[model samples]
Target: MDSQKKFWRSLWQLRVPNKIKHFMWKACNDALPTKENLHRRHVMDSTTCDLCREHLEDTIHALWLCKDISCVWSSLEWFHQAILVQPANFRELLARFRPCQDEYKVEIFVIAAWCVWNRRNALHFNRVVSLVTSICREAVFRASNVAGVGVIFRDNRGDPIGAMSMPVPFGQSMVEMEALACQRAVQFALEIGLTRVVVIEAFLNGSGQLASFENILGDIRFQAACFQHVEFNYISCACNSVADALAKKASSALVLQEWLEDLPDDIAPLVFREVH
Candidate 1:
């Protein structure tokens, strides 16, 4: 166990992107982007994509531009107009998005993309494929309605802590995304001076799971160890609605995060309305 810890410690010592390195300035919050999660709960398609045998079956091709995937891309008539790219790869595809000046549209893209992928994974595993257009449509709408804030603190655990709400891309780079998350987490950690805390999400684009915090980039290493002792966990969207609602309204309010043990009474209606 000690050796394993050393291995990750070595990675932190190694070189990482400069943009990510700057993330250390953050107070050590724990807001990680969804990590890669192509593995399955239970699907029967060959490990290789049925349509694109060149690569393993995964979300990238299914959502990007496989022949089967092309239909989905072609159908995003409205979104396509927002940015322009004939992506030969994922980098180009994401690059096409310019963080809308207001930052709200970027949130829509991130959250909706997560939902779209969720629906696709469901189809692949449960044989519940629905029209691609419908998925995109719901995603677009939910982008506007879906709400949740990731919470990062410096201590609640016996030691240290950090946490934050996930940020929307504002014509920003992936490195920028990591920095934004790290900044928020660090800010929270600095606020309380504990060793560890929780970073919960109301959304995921398959970046990182709730409890799995590793290699999350930035030269500083993990946020949980910011001071002494920190940890993380996940909550379902239904459970997260509380934070989501608070975050959306709370964002403009002069503070970065607001914590609650459960959904607030007044906001509960907004979540029900959004879902309905």
Candidate 2:
């Protein structure tokens, strides 16, 4: 019981976005709307795994043990080797990974699990099947380093309003880069006279315990106060590809670059695909 409490504490303290942490909490608690739980509640007619259709779609099967989703985990050599045991439940499955001791590994594990759930939902609801490689790639990227920051503005219909990319200074940590990105995103929203804005970030510091990024986050909060409504959303890197590309573009660009409706030719295609 003590170890389980400690696990929950560590999970809540992770630097990943709040939504992912909440998703993990729901998964561990069997509170997620997996097919088995939904069927038990009379919400779903069938409890079979939508992706694999070979087993009950409990939180454990949907996220970790599903045959269709196995490739996503096995793609990462470390995860493949770490999860040799097939645990009975979601909590036991997470315990096999020992998420509390190593923060980096835990972050990757949580993100990957969230991606699995997201992919499952997409397939089950929207009939959109995403590649396992894409899921794995997104999880790794979100947990890995931050080279730069990218901000893009769009309207309700996904029309591009504006976008910007800025390079991060040397010696800054990943969380610091994410904070800088938030600060710049808010500043850009204000510049464009957007009274209501939604900031979509691939990574965010949910826990403000790190002193290094707290000031930056504070500035973000302060600047965000300028707008009538400002909302922050956490999205997978796959959905955030344009911003990801812009951040990579920042490395070679001499100065901070901004674009209006006419984004650079390279990024325009990505946005096109994202919206359509």
lDDT of each: 0.42, 0.78
TM-scores for candidates 1 onward, in order: 0.31, 0.52
Tens digits of lDDT, candidate 2, 105-184: 77778888998888788887887665676676456456643355788999999989999987666334445666677789
Candidate 1: misplaced stretches above 4 Å? Answer: 1-167, 170-183, 201-216, 219-222, 250-276
Q: Report per-prediction Cα RMSD to one decimal.
A: 17.7, 12.4
lDDT, model 1, position 231: 40
- Give the number of colliding residue pairs in candidate 1: 37
TM-score of 1: 0.31
Clash count per candidate: 37, 0
